[model samples]
Target: MYRIMIADDEPMIRKGLQKLIQQSGQPIASLRLAENGIDALNQIRESCPDFLFTDIRMPKMDGLELCRHTAELDPDIQIVVVSGYNDFEYAQRCLSYGVKEYLLKPISKKTVEAALEKLVYLHSKHTSPAFVSVHRLEEWVGEAEAAIWSLNHETLVKVVQQARVEISSHRLRLHQLIDLLDEFTVLLFKRLHSRDIFLFTERAPLHAADDEDSAWSQFQARLVLFFDELRMKRRGKLKDPVEEAKLYIEAHLAEEVSLEDVAERIGLNASYFSQLFKQSTRETFVQYRTRRRMEKAKKLLAQPHYRITDISGEVGYADHPHFTKTFKKYAGCLPSEYRNKLGIDR
Candidate 1:
């Protein structure tokens, strides 16, 4: 859906265009009106309109001035000049701004239709190509590690491919950018398997577009906005009911922290909490707790401070036999083999 803005000092022209645009039933999903260039500038700043229709002349600020402002604001905004004159000089000047189509006023629905058709087509080609988005996603992730902390060749290649395939079903939009920040926070502190790919993809889109300094400001804003959105969502504090349940599981990994006890503490039905936890994290509560244990188990194995039996107990396996099977499931190696590899720091 394209959002369109019409800027004209004349009330009749603005209203008439708005009505004509709506009546035409064109592809434009939303239409906004600004009485003059000043009002139009505010609208441009607030919401980046997909298209702008402006008269060539106005009193305090002319259309040329508006075009210049809009260019500084967002170069991607498509402008279609509405003029009552046929002066080629003005046309030549507009070419510098890359105006889409200069329409002579006393305009009809047909002229507006043609302008929208061209604008929409151009936007798609520039912004939404399938392979281009995927390629950009990959390149963005691959570059991020170099810009911050380098990844090994194996990890770099693996991460970019994982990011491309696992960006979630979520689509990017101006508003959803807020929620993404919250998601980022969750990913940062949450337990991650070696395969978790989000921190790579999370920054990929921004890296694809801006430098570190500029992107950092925007990234922080997204997080702030997300907290605001969370307040809205919970109607109070960002009520994450599953948090306590996760905490309890972590505290009692060896004791068989069943879904029943964890869910009961959160005051939610056990089955329902189980589903929501899985839905949000892509891992069931049991699986996540076990994975966390295994990760701890690996870290302990790497350290020479603890013996193998002690490490198994540390990761919540009372029986070394049980720890061995679980380690094999995740590591494809017995606990002793993994421990031996760590002796030389492989």
Candidate 2:
């Protein structure tokens, strides 16, 4: 029978992990919950658990301090650090305190199961020598970090897949894979931090996997989904504002349409929207509106029923000579000349 403790500020996370450990069918002798690192430390002193799952950021003594204290109190207890974001520097600090496994936020059944399995393995090997030395662990972690920093998603996925396969093949322990993945995630996020991408910010809870292969497969699927959804979201962001601005300009061709008015309609700052509009459409607002009005005047001129003055008014111009000069500049011909080219005369 193994005693386990979950330390987190979130009631839901603590209760949820407790339920998952009980349902995993692991020989869990007892389960305990703590709202923060201080409470967790008190609980440990009162009754030292064989294993602990803790969140890095917590009130009244963060997970890092708790890990350090736990190490001094009970060096034999295995700990898995739980967190949401990937802070590589912070992870290195935690690793110094003997934390080998990391569980990402919104943890699911599969992750919980894997974590517990790793804890069980640690429990079994507590009195025995470690198969992989500390030096080897650092080497693998370095390799994982390099793959993530290279920014080649395919190569990174392949590297992670290879590691996953080793775990599935039983050549590597589950805890070791979790450590690599945790490092990879931290490096990946640090690389992508300045890109304004929100892939890791919010995530739904993933379901538990029954085995290593299933866990790895789920990880791959989530990556693909992240790229697909991120692409679609960014495309929409670039396309939507310009398209809406164009529609508004087209609808009010005879009225004043300033950048501020169009930006207001789109719920964006005028200067920012102006930049985005030009970036997306490759034309300044003045140039685009002038071209649109000239095009409309040309079409109306083709009808032969509308006079030059009416056509000018239709295209938002009240002065005939000014409109004529503008038409000649845009269309390379006077309005009458354009009508003649179209074989029409009033």
lDDT of 2 by residue, 286-340 (tens): 8899899998897898787798898888888878799999999998989899989
* Model 1, runs deviating above 4 Å: 130-346
The best candidate in terms of lDDT: 2
Candidate with the greatest TM-score versus the true structure: 1
Question: What are the runs in model 2 whose C-alpha is more than 4 Å off?
Answer: 128-346
Q: How big is the positional error of residue 217 in model 2, measured in Å on the Cα after superposition?
A: 54
- In model 1, the clashing pairs are none
lDDT of each: 0.67, 0.72
lDDT of 2 at 26: 86
In model 2, pairs of residues that clash are: 109-208, 110-208, 110-209
Clashes of each: 0, 3
